[model samples]
Target: MKYLSDQMLIEVYHRAVDLQLDSAFIELLRSELDHREIRIAQVSA
Candidate 1:
């Protein structure tokens, strides 16, 4: 297996969202993960 960088992962994620590759239910889950990551610095402070 190969590892993808955060940027690559985000790009792929966005592409998936654009294409509606995942079911409707998964979009919220993906949003939550992105939210958690964006809030990491605030949480650590």
Candidate 2:
């Protein structure tokens, strides 16, 4: 179970993607998500 709602998940993932300043490397990760909200147990920067 997650504390965040669907919209929150979307927002969080977008924020994570935004932090990927390494534009070249981020392409693959972002493409994998494909504009979908990800439900991961935890994300570590």
Candidate 3:
């Protein structure tokens, strides 16, 4: 996971969500993102 670039990491996260993968797996992705201090923007209505 560390080897993945920031863009790749975010892409993987999005892919996982689109595929409806397991929550644990998704959490792992989030954990990695947090570890790298990468922030994803949130759109509020």
* lDDT of candidates 1 onward, in order: 0.50, 0.52, 0.84
lDDT of 1 by residue, 1-45 (tens): 026555655665566666667555345545554764732222110
Rank by TM-score, highest first.
Answer: 3, 1, 2
**TM-scores for every predicted model:** 0.47, 0.42, 0.84
State how far residue 6 of model 1 sits from its true place (Å). 0.4
| Per-residue lDDT of 9 in model 3 | 93
In the predicted model 3, the residue pairs found to clash are none
lDDT-wise, the better of 1 and 2 is 2
Model 2 TM-score relative to the real fold: 0.42
Give the least accurate 10-residue stretch of model 3, judged by summed lDDT: 36-45
Q: What's the CA RMSD for each of the models?
A: 8.5, 9.1, 3.2
Q: Candidate 2 overall Cα lDDT vs. reference?
A: 0.52
Candidate closest to the true structure, highest TM-score:
3
